[model samples]
Target: MQASDRYRLSASATWVASVQMEPAIGAVAANLARSIELVEMAAAQGAQLVVLPELANTGYMFESREEAYALAEPVPEGRSSQAWIALAQRLGIYLVAGISERAGGRLYNSALVTGPDGYLGTYRKLHLWGDENLYFEAGDLGLQVFDTELGRIGVAICYDGWFPEVYRRLALRGADIVAVPTNWVPMPGQTRDGAVIAHALTMGGAHSNGLTVVCADRIGTERGQTFVGRSVIVNSQGWTAAGPASVDQEEVLLAPIDVKATRRARQLNDFNHLLRDRRPDIYDEQSGATAGLRQR
Candidate 1:
């Protein structure tokens, strides 16, 4: 089948990468090394923007907060963050990789966005899942988008993908793409489309928000917790642009993402604009007057 025109023929598309891998518990150095190796592999494959899975530096499922604190390091200054930044600098590409962030007395789950020039910014996970709350404080940095030469890149981690508002806010703030660093667990049910139900959430977010999503998920069983890998890239129209990589294997998925195309797609037609047509005045979920939903 022929590909639909999502981008202008004249505009350059950036090749993006989603890397899925299993990280060992407490193997900080080794995990960072492996993550870098996977990123380098993606770089060699002509990927200009690469994303690694959540907690790629320190394994998820920490036994205690002390253990997590001991392993966590300050963002940008930490060895893991610095190493990823250095790799992006050396490869002359952009990267978003998850790390365990230590700031003063708190530890938060974070994704650091780095580019060829230097460190860009960090997006701390806004929504914590399962035992993450036990080891890390809820992210206070808010959902952040980094402006880069490739495009405006936003970030979200594992559980954050579950909230559609995360993507909506990013898109509202002018994000062209969202890099999801996730350690997705198996949902109870499967979808008819050959992907897990969790995959639907990411795709739905992309479609609804008009944001291209690059999700990097981890595989294998960790401390009795099993992760559903299937790393994927969803285009603005909610179609699978690249992978839903293997569920139990280390892998890299790459696809061309044109931000200009995404922007144009948000128009839908001459009379409608996806973001411009929003009725925030009618969506006062807090009051629950005209809206059926309530803010959590």
Candidate 2:
């Protein structure tokens, strides 16, 4: 092999881990400004990419389905996403953010990933938790992953974190990291001071899938509901680079990540190798009952 070829292969990986936690139920204009402020700050701090909390532009709690509908907006065409794309271009950094997305005539909780080049891609929340079913429609699309200056990354909105398979599928398909933008409601009867369940879900998904998982969430009380804002970054080994938690203020959180570590971990443990070891021959419930001549 040529010396230049070896040098290129050995080039160091450059990336950043960052999150923005918006104050819950805050005014739209205020939230947007805070988000923009953080975007610029993260870029100045050397972040190649930044992720803001789920529904960071709008608070998560709702009084009725109509309220959620009122907050929803079309992607790229909507005010919130348009601002995000423009900001990404301005800062020349990749951005991942969650928003209430409007489609056709209904709304779906969704996440969008944008790069300096332009708006890159989006993913809608596929698994709606209890109360969410009452307001948002579940997205039927499969997991999405895209290439960025940092690395190949996948986006999964809130409830999607509970299902480890989502991360597994993305990692198997070549995602080096997964970004989760969430508005995590505390479990049934747990006190806010108790160990955060959402962080556990995020770390579990990352460790099991052999990838780093970064999450951003909103904080403060909104419409009679309260959230424990602990926006965090977790490594493939399930360790928190930041603490166990943080508050829901309009704050910028940053950490450094080594992309090469993700590849090495996957090669060593290969926890997600199950994607290739599946036995489809006996898994017939997915389609025709009689297997003699299954319909295409």
Candidate 3:
């Protein structure tokens, strides 16, 4: 409320939501129906940006690569993608959802982004986890930061959040918010404080990068694998803006995010800035990541 703090914001705040739901295996029709319903609910509650869980269409746990291909569809033009685009246009809001994308005779775990203007772009998941390697190709699309009326938005999938580099790279590319569509499972070795492994990852990613992180995770067991369902939204200060919802329920976490303040939070105190303080002059990725970005 102080006049000096006005520099933390450049425009109005945006109301966003993380829609947590359970999608069934290969049940494209049913999953699409349910996801549409939940997005509508979030919009009804005044969400300008709504994010859905990973594999929001065909679900996780494919029986085979053949099954995965059978359930996957093309990007933007796919029936599922078209439906979601229409929903975003109708609601006059931005929507991000996970989909099983079939492209170039290969299958990818992808997220489709849409807005009131229509289809925006697709982000193929960079890090494939567990059985994902067996069925889906590791994401080919590099870090993509989408500029929208609300702000600069970015997308990441489940396993991608595990790497600090992913968040760091997105922040470096000028992203204000990172929408994570995840299907989280339990991490081995419980902590003394009993914090959720996912909480540590998302909150840390947000605080270190000064980005708002909105995660929508799925629940339920399919083919003997259970998903941990504590969906959450983390603010730039590494604090909970909304949830870490129930471990067994379907829920929608809605919150108002001050994106400009988040971007400004990168400046800690009067002397240090998170991004500017990086010692990239002496340190290097050594993993060839910079070369890849340059090629792109």
The candidate scoring highest on lDDT is 3
Q: What are the runs in model 1 whose C-alpha is more than 4 Å off?
A: 1-11, 190-194, 286-296
Task: Give me the displacement of residue 182 in model 2, in angstroms.
Answer: 0.7
Instruction: Write candidate 3's Cα lDDT for 175-246 as tens digits.
Output: 999999999887787542356888899999999999999999999998998888889999988899998788
Model 1 agreement with the true structure over 105-165: per-residue lDDT tens digits: 9999998889999899988998989888898899998878888888889999988888888
Q: Extract clashing residue pairs from model 3.
A: none
Candidate 1, clashing residue pairs?
Answer: none
Residue-level lDDT tens digits of model 2 in 1-296: 43245335545634444565654453667777788887787777666778888877777876678887887789878988999999999888889988888888888888878989999987888999777899899986679889876888988888888887788779878888888888777787777677788888877877766788888777777777777777788887777865445655555566556787777665444454524544556554465345655644
Supply every candidate's count of residue pairs whose N, Cα or C atoms clash at under 3 angstroms: 0, 0, 0
List the candidates ranked by TM-score, beginning with the highest.
1, 3, 2
lDDT of 1: 0.88
RMSD of each: 3.9, 6.2, 5.6
lDDT of 1 at 155: 94
